[model samples]
Target: MTEDTSWVGPAMQQRVPWVKAVGITFGDVTARRVVAHLPDDPQLHNHVGGPHAAMIFGLGETASGAVGLAAFGSVMDRATPLVVSSEIAYHRLARGPLTAVAELTRPAEEVLAELAGGQRPEFTVTVGISDTDARETTRMVVRWTLRPNR
Candidate 1:
């Protein structure tokens, strides 16, 4: 039987306290997308009293990583994920809590097929950070690759 890994998000925060320190909250996880939030708080506030840019980046990365794991966990059993590359675009300022949602640009099945074929697959995931009003404040694309665990 396969072990349930639904606790991945919270467990990761527990294992890496820094993530929790930045006020990252793990949310919905599915084969389609992964969601996380950066709550509004002093710890994550910037000079203008908005979420720090670094915090936004961190939240986006975390959300993308979760989506990758959810989509390719089995194929990654013998490998580990690495952030090969990433790009972020800041659209506007976030004045309150922000939500980050990440999902693959392509179909999960196609990416999995490449992995199943013994090819090291790389997928691009797009994360959109939105404010409490659901307006996009930041957008990021994270390219992930799996490398054999040594």
Candidate 2:
């Protein structure tokens, strides 16, 4: 199972018990576009009672990674990739429901084609985390070495 589609996405959640336990959802998983869902849980609270930094970090990181997965059309058949590094900044306090969007950087289509045909592509997945109120809480940049499946 992979996180590129609904069936596979939810199915693979079992592999990451911690993430699933925290109520993170892989809503849209496709190349060039990535989106994720997060519930406003109390466990994600900070000293001030807003979402904790780690929670925001997790949401932003996952969203960025998902974008790379989506850039490949389907992550169902690819090898599990690891995050080499992540650098993010919080613009404001995160509140309410949050949505993360990752738009592919570089030549997305060409890179995906190469990856599907047996190539390892290193790229940056830029993502933004926002709330249902249409407010952005953070901007994240995730860099990874993507090894896709044929």
- Pick by lDDT: which candidate is best? 1
**TM-score result, candidate 2:** 0.77
Q: What are the clash counts of all predictions, listed in order?
A: 0, 4
lDDT per residue for candidate 2 within 1-150, as digits (tens), equals 433344435643666676687788877676666678788887778888777888888877767765654554355467456676787988888787788887668876676676677777667878899976879989988887765534
Residue lDDT tens for model 1, 1-150: 544558768765886687777768877887668889888887778898888898889889988988887777776667787899999999998879889999888887887777667777788999999998999999999998877655
| lDDT score at residue 96, model 2, on the 0-100 scale | 74
Q: What's the TM for model 1?
A: 0.87
Steric clash pairs (candidate 2) = 30-70, 31-70, 31-71, 32-71
lDDT score of model 1? 0.83
Runs in model 2 lying further than 4 Å from the true structure? 1-4, 73-80, 112-120, 147-150
Off by over 4 Å in 1: 1-5
